[model samples]
Target: MGGFFTPDPPPPSPPPPPVIVTDPEAEAAQARQDAIARNRRGLAGTIATSETGLLQPSQGVGKSLLGE
Candidate 1:
């Protein structure tokens, strides 16, 4: 009988593993571009912070360099 004598069907075979290919030269170029962009952003941030500080009022604005 199907219920008593039939052996269970073998488990379905696992799916084949995926293959990935990469270009080392392209990857290195991309990394270099990213680093350059990061540096630009850091410089921009520093400039922005300095500009913002200059625009804000501070107690030291009128004070002399000699503490007069």
Candidate 2:
């Protein structure tokens, strides 16, 4: 009588790739660029509001629009 036999198991998967080390200088440069971009947007918005006189103080404490 013939006997049943099992096939060999598949090979193990390859290991994952190694992690890369980031450069501090490059990170700092990117942060600086981001900050500059953010500042530019803020400055533009401030300028637009100031031009429209929206940036003036809301309250006139002990003061008047015209000479007292």
- In terms of TM-score, how similar is model 2 to the real structure? 0.46
What are the RMSD figures for all models against the true structure?
7.8, 10.7
On residues 1-68, what C-alpha lDDT tens digit does candidate 2 reach at each position? 33468666778999999999999999999999998888887755657556536556656566555687
* Candidate 2 off by > 4 Å: 1-4, 43-68
Which candidate comes out best when scored by lDDT?
Answer: 1
Query: What would the TM-scores of all predictions be?
Result: 0.50, 0.46
Clashing pairs in 1: none
Write the residue-wise lDDT of candidate 1 on 1-68 in tens digits.
24687887778899999988899999999999998888887755556566547556776666656767
Residue-level error in angstroms, candidate 2, position 17: 2.4
Model 1 bad stretches (over 4 Å): 1-5, 43-68
